[model samples]
Target: MHPARRSAGWMQTRFFVMKKKLLSLILTGLGILVLPNAALGAEPKTIGELVTKISNALYSAMSGIVLIAWIVIAFLYLTAWGSPEKLKTAHHAVIWAAVGTAILVLYKSIEPIIKNALGV
Candidate 1:
């Protein structure tokens, strides 16, 4: 065999091996990321349980965000220090925040009724 041909063949083989290893690593990482803790031997949740857990998490997160925003609005008002522009900006923020909170409440209130109507 010619030396140049032998080297080319070796390089091709190495590239194939590296490609396979890279694909394997990606699939393994994806498996770890996607699998739930329960799939690893803990108790698995039912569909309803999963839905409830996800909903609760979303509700809690939204409530916490609204509370934090209100606190921020309060600080903005306190530090306005007689500036009309700052107070006006804070007032606009409060109005938007209240609207967001109302939407969140409306969703929570309607979700259960919708679920019941749909028999889910």
Candidate 2:
């Protein structure tokens, strides 16, 4: 492989891994923050409990989605590097999708906080 292309590939892999780690960390933190303390008060079979269970499941799924996105983005980036236009498009899509995923995860993680904040 050409030296320049090799270096770009290495950089892309490293960058994608770093981004994935950072995103995961942030999501974990949000998970910690938004989880309710209902264990101290609410019953296990109550609606609150059911909602919490659903939220936990959604979080798990989003976590998987983020992991898959990282893999797909990494592949797209590595292949598209040879073509500036394609690489640009792939990078843009990856970043935007990641951002949207973050927002959705954040919302799901902190839905209670949101409701309280808005007095809903």
Best by TM-score: 1
Off by over 4 Å in 1: 1-45
Query: Per-residue lDDT tens digits of candidate 1, residues 1-120?
Result: 999999878976886686578557755654554344334443326655555555655665666567657766876786676899999999999998999799788867766775576577
Q: Which ten residues in a row have the lowest lDDT in candidate 1?
A: 35-44
Q: What are the RMSD figures for all models against the true structure?
A: 19.0, 7.7
- Can you write out model 2's per-residue Cα lDDT over 10-91, one digit (the tens) per residue? 9988978887997788667556544544234545575566566666656655665666667667767866848989899788
TM-score of each: 0.56, 0.52
Supply candidate 1's per-residue lDDT for 41: 48
Model 2: residues with Cα > 4 Å off, grouped in runs: 1-44, 114-120
Error of 1 at 22 (Å): 45
**Native-referenced Cα lDDT, model 2:** 0.69
Question: What is the Cα-based lDDT of residue 12 in candidate 1?
Answer: 69
